[model samples]
Target: MACMEFTPEHRGTVRLEAREYGRSVLGAPLLYYPCRSACRLLVFAAIHGEEPETTFLLSRCLRAFDTNFEHVAFVLCANPDGATLGTRGNANGVDLNRNFATSNWNPAHVQSRSILESARDTLLSPGKAPGSEPETQALVALIESLKPESVIAMHSPIGCIDAPARTPLVERLQGTLNLPWKPDIGYPTPGSFGTWCSEHRVECITLELPRLAPELLFERYGESFARFLAAQD
Candidate 1:
């Protein structure tokens, strides 16, 4: 992505510092900006490098919100390296997703995203260890600093909402979106934003959108979110 294509504000906060990791070859610099509301939402996309649709969706919604909401968040693309290469790992071949110190952290495959695979080929490996990748470290630090009340980890093609399952907000999300609330689908990811949020006691949504309908994502997810927020009020 051309960093210049984005206006100054879209380029992320000018005061925001740039962090590096994993040779810093494959990814673009991560960015963060403040929201208009006291409450904030952390939107992550392209965790799986193959799922580029979510990134576009997130970008669209963010620019749209910049025009519409008058309030949004520091939309951060957690792994620019992976996103650029269209691979699950960073330039160093580490599956930084699995690098988190979550309970299910994998030791072997974590060092190599290519080693681990699932039915749908979602690589659930971390790097040699949690917080290994600079990308991951930057994300962890951002999450810790922001301590957002709500979060949305964007993933794709599932078209459903999944979380810790026990969160009452899941039901509220289910009712609003008419999507099922599911358990942490056995794909154990240690130190992942989702699991990390659980540890921090933050209510989050792992919103899985269909890779095909990139345009309608905000409409679909936002409609549900708007309804959910209204109910909370």
Candidate 2:
């Protein structure tokens, strides 16, 4: 069943032992909550340090439960250094999401906007080489080891469910979140995790939460989202 009725005490009380997969540029441990049984899904948040909302919302959802889910592992924060520094990229100024060792990974600097409406005014490196960053390499290794049936990569502000294929999982997420499902985010993402998943034949779903404040987001979706996971199990 879904977690006991979520209460104020449960908001920050749910605990799970984290296994270290790797360390970040700042020596922060890359931690993941491993599932107790065979892993079928891996949910990760905060690949972009600037998007702490993703990490916050995922944490709130995970905290609703006291123990690990049987089929889902969790990465609460993929780029601790970036989150700490409040930069989109890691300490090395490389966007970790674009540092995956995929065929299309490139060394060219990437352009991102300051805000949703702003121009693409910021430039960041993809990395010295594909999988150059420790966080990227470690996450890749962990995913290969777990070999989950699907991965849910959390991001924010675009407010859509993005998957290359309109599979049932994506459809479910779209329906649950009341968001549109798109074939793409309408831009080229050369070295994204989604692209890497495609190369490895793994199903990936990008959940871009709406543009809402972290607490407000939790207030709106916390209970329903928790039940969604419980139903999955």
Candidate 3:
């Protein structure tokens, strides 16, 4: 197929062929852009609604492409309800990050700081049970189906890349984003996708974008990010 033209003028109009992986609690469509070829990487963003910038930046980078990825799949907004509601959690007030069915999956409420400088004032349910939410279940199913070698779970305003080990992929991301890499996020993430990936033996890299304005992030990383994905193809 001819690659779709994706100039800035076509940004709003250009659309990728997205498949419905599942639905949210409010019946919002859980969408994902499947790779056109073998899937090597599964990159997801905006699992937390409050960090819409992750979605925005990924969307912008995607808009630069005219065709499906040759080896990379994408989930621009993993938590549509939360993104729409401008909350960190989904419609059920569950932190989707903490809802994964991992060995450390905790039923206890997850505490998150509202602002970087603020205390952990916000509390959210992990879920009725691990992988209980439809979104979480669907994502797990998708990962199983795709069998990607690695996954990039995008988050924001933390200004660092979080991974268990400094794999080649992590090193490339560190160079691409020009951000420091951390062994962990400096806190316990009981049921995080990273933890789930570890148990499943799939590599997961949490790409925590810096605390930059949306436009600035795009301005600095947009083209470079597009080129990075293209390199994977």
Top lDDT prediction, candidate number: 3
The global Cα lDDT (0 to 1) of model 3 is 0.89
Angstrom error of the Cα, residue 45, model 3: value is 0.5
Query: Could you tell me the lDDT of residue 116 within candidate 1?
Result: 26
Please give, for residues 1-233, the per-residue lDDT of candidate 2 as tens digits: 33545778777655866899999999999999988888888999999999999988888888878888888889999999999999999999999889998999988999998999999999999999889999999999999999999999999899989998889888777767788888999998989999999999999999998999999988887767777767666
TM-score-wise, the better of 2 and 3 is: 2
- lDDT digits (tens) for residues 1-233 of candidate 1: 10122344553423323233223434466665554445455666776675677777555434422222223344446667777877876776666656666776557554322322433434345676766777777777766776677777877666678886546656666776676667764555556667777777877788776545555665666444543433442
Worst 10 residues of 3 by lDDT: 1-10
What lDDT does each candidate get?
0.59, 0.89, 0.89
lDDT of 3 by residue, 113-164 (tens): 9899999999999999989998899999999999999999999898999999
Provide the TM-score for each candidate, comma-separated: 0.71, 0.97, 0.96
Every candidate's CA RMSD: 6.7, 1.1, 1.7
Query: Could you tell me which 10 consecutive residues in candidate 2 have the lowest summed lDDT?
Result: 1-10
Where model 2 places Cα greater than 4 Å from the true spot, the runs are 1-4
The best-first sequence of candidates by TM-score reads: 2, 3, 1
- Candidate 2, residue 1: the lDDT equals 38
Clashes of 3: 0
